[model samples]
Target chain A: MTRNETVDVLIIGSGASGAAVAWSLAETRMNILCLEQGDWTRPTDFPANGRDWEARRYGDFAISPNERARVTDYPVNDADSPMKVANFNGVGGGTIFYTAHFPRLHPSDFRVRSLDGVASDWPIDYWALEPFFAENDRMMGVSGLAGDPGVPARDPPMPPIPLGRTGAAYARAMNRLGWHWWPSDTTVATTEYDGRAACINLGHCTPGCAQGAKASTDITYWPRALRAGVKLRPRCRVREITLNEHGMAAGAIYYDADGAECFQPAEMVILAANGIGTPRLLLNSASARCPDGLANSSGLVGRNLMLHPWPQVSGYVAETVDGGRGPMTSLWSKQFYETDPARDFVRGYTLQFARGAGPVAEAVDSLAAGRLPWGEGHHRAFRALLDHRLRIGIACEDLPEAHNRVTLDPELTDSDGIPAPKIDYRIGENTRRMMAHGIARATEIMEAAGATQIGVSPTLNSPGHLLGTARMGTDPEHSVVNPWGRCHDVRNLFIVDGSIWVTSGGVNPTSTIQALALYIADRIKQRLATLFDPG
Target chain B: METSQDSGLSALEIDALRRLAGVLIPPDAALAMPGADDPDILADLLATLGRDQARVQAALGALLAAGFAAAAPAEAETLARSRMATAGPEAGTLGRVILQCYYRDPRVLRALGQDPRPPFPGGHVLEQGDWSLLDPVRARTPFWRDDRAGAA
Candidate 1:
């Protein structure tokens, strides 16, 4: 085993949170190094560069790590979970394939327990992270209108991307229904900013943005972090976090790209591996001092897993909506975002109106649903469904449940022979009710939009927003991390990823996750003198 | 028809695919759109068959078991619908390969009114929807719960 030189700080996983924290801590001029298991994603190598772009979604650019299964990728044992794990292992992480639909959590989202009498309230509130959110928006170059009544009034950096035909139809429907709708805040640049070119409406943003319009962390933060002297070593798969005699995280033992074992010591360690990855690492690092896990004193290192359940309603309208012509998501509705006493479910869902699928996806999906038959009048069916379809995806808020957790799969191991994460998750009753309500409401909107045919997917297997595995709270007994992302059990160890999210809000979480990383980095800088004070 | 030796597909498998592709997507004279069984599309399908040979063969087996070749055109259509148009794994794999290859064809793409090229460098322009549509929504008072002023 090779023992490398020590550093002032070490960060694991160079995805959304890792890149943000690295950039934030760069100005401190500390010897900071981030170890990423995946390499940088070359924009030219993205699927959209070829005519087989849409087909690549099911292949190389698939959201599921198990499906993509590159050498750098690790398999996730998600067969037991209804909602499958969707993540990319590259430097930009999930953002590499994210549709870039950006939405910040509402003020009420922080106080879930206080407001709805369910789940635990976050130690920090939305107001505390508001400044960081704004900062992240600016850095990520969010594009949207200012006057959204669904959340706080904050103008984005660029004008909203054009609401193409599909968005227009949904907007008109929402207006007719007297529901609140706004042009969505997306990370895709509408006008050129920060050296990246504006979107040319190539339409396939999920499979990595070859156009460089989508704001993946690699394009937004990693470059700045690298320029600021943060040494980010890619393809170094961390095996475990080692502890000194006192149980403080000394550093990590990782496997280099050549499959050689190496140990790199550091003064402090931060885990930015997302919800599942963080817990898997902790569980795999079980030692005699901390038998359960490194930060498992609370017995909650891998508990309280929250995956936002997504249900969608798709339909076909008479007019051509230009299915694959613009950003995946251009407009959204927050009508059912908050709690209503009359409703069965407590927290509600965000209605994201997105364009329909590309030709290949639509055909495959429709055929699977038995909507498009393979004979006789197939042409008529194809024409009616192809470019005329639109979708309303309901991002349902899933509260934390102890039973839904991430454990190291005893049988499944990665290429490096490290145990993979086994997810045992199921949608809760509240989320199920919320999905039903969302489907009914979305059906109404589809009808209002003059949709001739409509279809409902009660639950989509795509669990892109993984949250709350290593929840942060004031109570150490019930949480893994403290309010500022410091580990409750280990003072020198910190987590600044979705794993620290107390609750999964009913929206895409990249924006909030990045803001929390920035907030944690700021807190770390503020308490530089007393950062490791065992208090 | 020239055999696709590189694809490793048998003459029987090629014939089976040729038979199935026609019923899967019949050509439209009115729209001037070629079906999945068009000479150009079938050739492309043969070349691409190597990638998904197992799944395609499985689907073909299912079709043959259902007596798709012996049935009348209408009966064959019914058999295909019942056997291939399903949520089953074999159906999914078959549908994906057939549709992916068919849609990527320049003739099929043009018939569908899509530009027959990759979706980059020559991206399409879209009309920005009317901003005035949000006037009614903007008129409503902010509905967010202000935590600073205390819980609602």
Candidate 2:
């Protein structure tokens, strides 16, 4: 429709990574366009009631304009497509509902292949990215303790969250087990530093923080970018990245808010659309010149999909602990974070303790645990046990295998008329052994803590913290992007999200993603003169 | 009956629940709040519960019965006695089960300063530890300042 807009840089997906990059480059004076497939929802818009919140949690009655622009609901299967990745569809992307657990990857995590011979080593080391990580931490207002023995030492911008009953229990357990557990390095403000209020322990971080305590990108980076004059187009789903004659990124073709076709030209394109969408968009942008997929000369556009296998262990306590009343998870132990040759698994796993069971979710759990659906006895049992249940979750690192990849299913197409990302993944032997070990340790801890009953459940496709689709490496044959997160085939294109991760570290990926985004943004800024001069 | 014990299960509380249930039900349903003798009282409430004694005890309480029938002295007394009888550990597994369900019901949850909508907005029972983790954060500015200050 003869729609054309030009900018110095175009960022697809205003998520944790995209927003961070946009914010970092805010003062560059370069024209930047950040497109998000979700609407800009404010904290005040969240529902106060539990049922209404639950409905929104399931993405029901979400802002419809954004929904039509992007296909939010896609099926998750085990054999063909099995990744329960719940990404947010708004200006902030999944950061809106993400538990602000921003932990940096351990230094050894970068050189896993050298250290443990389990996974491939990252092209970039932790030292190279440390400055960016520190910068990102300060910018994002991370609250944590400095000099954590488990990882490198860095001063947190804010103080850590206080240890509550559960944290105390977890700490005691860790002490007894002689494991190294530390306060989570989260993005939530410990004290009133920024304009945002401090955490109130509302325990509803997943459905979006009404209290503005959880540090989502909207509250942290998006505002900074907006203030810096970075143009953010919400409800704009990028369909394809158009290339020039020289094979550089010309611009992007996207569906605007009204579902109309629009093309926005840019000197450079930084794809932070996440692992799944980033590769999907690249594959969809195939032309006669780039038939194998955009910037996919090595034929690894959507290869090496990695998801941190999540296995949960629930403990039923005797006292009315009220586990579900606070944040998602309060305490974590990285004692097993480093791989042990003594253990059967190649990679290690972290043990995180979270308060358990919202009423409805608790009911479902109870039903699963053989609680009778009805009768006086059933009701009594439910009430007596409601306050005493606690759950321990392990975000076990899954080794990257070439076989576990994200490919488009030729048979099924999403509502957006594009093939849905077909995730072919299974928990490898290393992860299964890790899960079993972690569960055994968790059961021991629970029993030691006087748990009357304990249950463990481990599944392959626990979607939240996804990584390693388009891995970064020194050689283009083995990876999609280079050590600097720049596309090996296309210099003008960059990937700063979880997609560029070479190894899925045991911790949450947000901190690492944000750090990489900052590093990449710095590189882009340094080369802005040559890249965006348009000579 | 001791008057002090009777005060806990006020006649008014029993009457309020009876009215509340009526509002929850569809207007088209002919099912009135069954009387004590109405065989369906056990069946209707226990139908969804199946053979679970806990569900039965929790659902077959003073507040639940009030919603089914018009307030009467005998009904109130019977409901109060049922509640007290199940209050003890001697009330067995069945009694404990019902007690738990009753407490979790939306009506009771609201009365206990809990928002049933967010389920447990302040956090769930297990969330106490999570709250503790946020304590360093919460101590600076509490999550429930308004509620703590007794302000709506």
Point out the worst 10-residue segment of candidate 1 chain A by lDDT: A457-466
Best by TM-score: 1
Itemize residue pairs with steric clashes in candidate 1.
Answer: none
lDDT by residue (A223-306, candidate 2, tens digit) is 888988999988777888988998888989877767788888888899988878888889888998899789898888877778
Going through the candidates in the order shown, the clash numbers are 0, 60
Per-residue alpha-carbon lDDT of model 1 for A199-221, expressed as tens digits? 99998998888899999999999
- The CAPRI classification for model 1 reads as medium
What is every candidate's C-alpha DockQ against the true complex, given to 2 decimals?
A: 0.72, 0.12
